[model samples]
Target: MGIKSALSRPLAAYVVHRDRQWQREPVAAQLRLLRRLAATGAPTAFGRAHDLGALRTPADLARLVPVRDYEGLKPYFDRTQAGEADVLWPGRPLYLAKTSGTTSGTKYIPITRASIGNHINGARDALLHYVHATGRSRFLDGKLMFLSGSPVLEQHHGLATGRLSGIANHHVPAYLRRNQLPSYAANIIEDWEAKLDRIVEETLPEDLTLISGIPPWVQMYFDKLLQLTGRPIKDIFPNLNLFVYGGVNFAPYRAKLFESIGRPIDSIELFPASEGFLAFQDEPGNPGLLLLLNSGIFFEFVPAERFFEANPPRLTIADVELDRQYAVVLTSNAGLWGYSLGDTVRFVGLAPPRVVVTGRLKHFLSAFGEHVIGEEVEGALREAMTQFPAVEVVELTVAPRVSADPGQPSRHEWLVEFARPPADAAAFAGALDGALRRRNTYYDDLRRGNILVPLLLTPLPAGAFQRHMKRLGKLGGQNKVPRLSNDRALAEGLVENP
Candidate 1:
């Protein structure tokens, strides 16, 4: 075996330091991390309530609170919706980081003092770790454009308003508050059409070298940038580095975005989320996901079988074996005790556990009684896209709907934006159609004969993606584009006309 990665262990140790000393402690010695978080204020109250039940081993947390989903937090949510002071966070409640679920309701996850501390530490830790792993300090090379939720803050307009992008930024650490191109309050709730226009006109820095946010939204930004410059984006920001993104899957758009900028996925990095900055693509050569501050939050792994069942055994950090898909659960300084963020992960190893996010247990297409997951969809899309040479997919989304025809079948539909515009839409559509049917059984039957039509290829306007960013008010900076929509309302609204 190779001796060691030059920068990984030291970077891992730094990440561990952020989690109140628990993150760095060995898996077998994190009881101290638990005790430290529990002794603090605000967290101490809720932590006591969860009891977190003696985390001597991964199996121990199972004895405390079982893995929980948002549906399980109805009481806390109700308290929050009612403006109860003691709803989620026990202290003065530093702030709220609002994230939306697949369905309608907004989840105002409490970001306490510890959570804020961890967020800042992790954000910086990720930077430091990236440098260590790559021996590069491109962090300040170019301004990072974040395509995110609205930056505007509206007071009590409605509960769902909490999911706006601007409100979520409230919890971002003070240190990072300035590097942003525009204040998030400018993105949140407003006339998106106008905000995007101003954002497009004002922000697009000449020195921009890095772009961050979700894939779809960044694609939109590239579209807008092209409209403004009338030249290749690669020509505009010649030094643009990587696209740091999260919130949804990125495989589908990898081809499209790269074709636009004439680059590849290595220029981008995926991230960890609310549960913790769980893992990141550390070293390009390694092709492995690096676990962050492992000692900070104790990790537990339950076989896929136990994810939805009543009594799943929680495997400790030391107990995790490589290459196994597990339902993720965590105990952290953020005051989340034995909380199941409702996501799945795959481990590449045990010690320091290199891992990759697999899929979200909650977000899947169950409308057809067929359980299709994020990974399956990503796999099929990549497999289909591989059919063409020099083709990059800019926009790809899946939806479930019944057509108006008498014998119509339930189907998966996609809208692809390509770098080299296809000469024949019908031929291009047919090739992708044949590939999907062959790759997936349920889908194959859906397209057998007259059931579901082959996948539809929508040719976007020259600056089509930009119109989307302008519409969403994510002209520049860590904003994201919507990846999958079951309903066509939003997609139709986003459709481009040349």
Candidate 2:
């Protein structure tokens, strides 16, 4: 056996136990998680106020703590940030992860020691799952380039605060850190453009086996590497066998990323957020990510269609039905109590409980009463891209455009920046529109009614969104272009860029 495989036996063993229990008694696992949380967090003000100590069942816990968003929990989070002890978790957070959003601005998410450990353990379990499925550990002996944010964190009242990737980078095991790409000095560069430049310089010659990052940013790196080496990534890094990605749907970039790499390699999808490590893709063939029921995060699901309703019903893992969309509400060891992560997901597997992240709850275009989600839009775009074999969509976003004149009907406006421009941009947009109409009945009805005008497609100049993000100081890390927006500000801003 390989040394890495031998050392990972315990983790592999835990995966076996966890997967068996997940398949057999997922509900029991969730109950045990809640009970454990009640014990650990019982002393905190949030726990005491919610009567978490006395809670003996999931139903009891749910009834006591109302589902809350970041704004709802901001007060307690503020106190915790101000050095208060046990305001939410057992004590003060080990660090704060700054999660940036267009609507909510920046949110400081607490990360306790236990929560950080769970994040690390989740990453380990992801690899262990891969090893178990494929019986391959040769990649373990080679280097891993984590194309993440700057690791040098800023101090906030004696507590480190930075991006989630940066926070996790601080806790990366020394053994793996030895193989992680980009020198410490290169990684600490705050400017993403500068960091990418330095990363290319430092790791271009390394024998990298694994690469992990958000898809768009990694695409940028791949493009840049191709520009520098005049060779495909597979040729440059011959041993590069695995690609781990998250923070956006990989569908649109699948073809483009493959083209840049010049070949297919193993890929894993992770559904991690600053709030918690939620799920990760377990099966190579299956696109669905397996929810981590025992990973220090208690989950509740509120149907996405009814999320805005007053007192929307929150269902636990045991009650979630397959193929139904739900907004994820999580109570984690990270001090977030009954917090809604704002991401929507649909369960594909009930036995072991697997889910596919659909979209963000707030990030939908429903101006004309035809609600179009990120998943639907992305899927439509992917289908359309299949027709234009030569074109590659680099970045895109959509917003509603209500006519200024009274007689005009409203329509959807798409701003797309392509790496390889389509021969016929109008034809491409038409295909995308037709695909959306087929996928969303509401959208199709509105179009057929002439209440909404034909979808308008505007080809944005390359790097437009990247430039906008850079201006917003959100050019990299977990920050991504919001796929769908109600307001035209973000899309228009990118369009307005000369």
**Model 1 spans > 4 angstroms off:** 1-26, 29-32, 35-56, 80-90, 102-104, 138-142, 150-179, 183-189, 262-268, 272-276, 285-287, 294-296, 366-370, 400-411, 415-498
Which residue runs of candidate 2 sit more than 4 Å off their true CA positions?
5-14, 102-104, 404-408
**Tens digits of per-residue lDDT for model 2, 1-498:** 556657766667678667776668889889888889888888889888988889888788778988888989888987887878989988788988887754567888889988997787777778888877877767877788898888778888778999888888877777777777877899899889999999999888798989999899999899889989899999999989898998899988888898999998899999989888899888887988989888889899999999889888889987899988899999888988889899999899987899999999989999888889999999899888888888888889999998868687688998888889889888998999999999899999999988887799988887888889999888977788889988888977887773
Backbone clashes in model 2: 0
> What lDDT would candidate 1 get against the real structure?
0.58
Error of 1 at 264 (Å): 4.8
TM-score of candidate 2 to 2 decimals: 0.96
- Highest TM-score, which number? 2
Report the C-alpha lDDT of model 1 over 402-483, residue by residue, as the tens digit: 6666776445565555666666667666776676566557766656655666666666655555566666554544444444
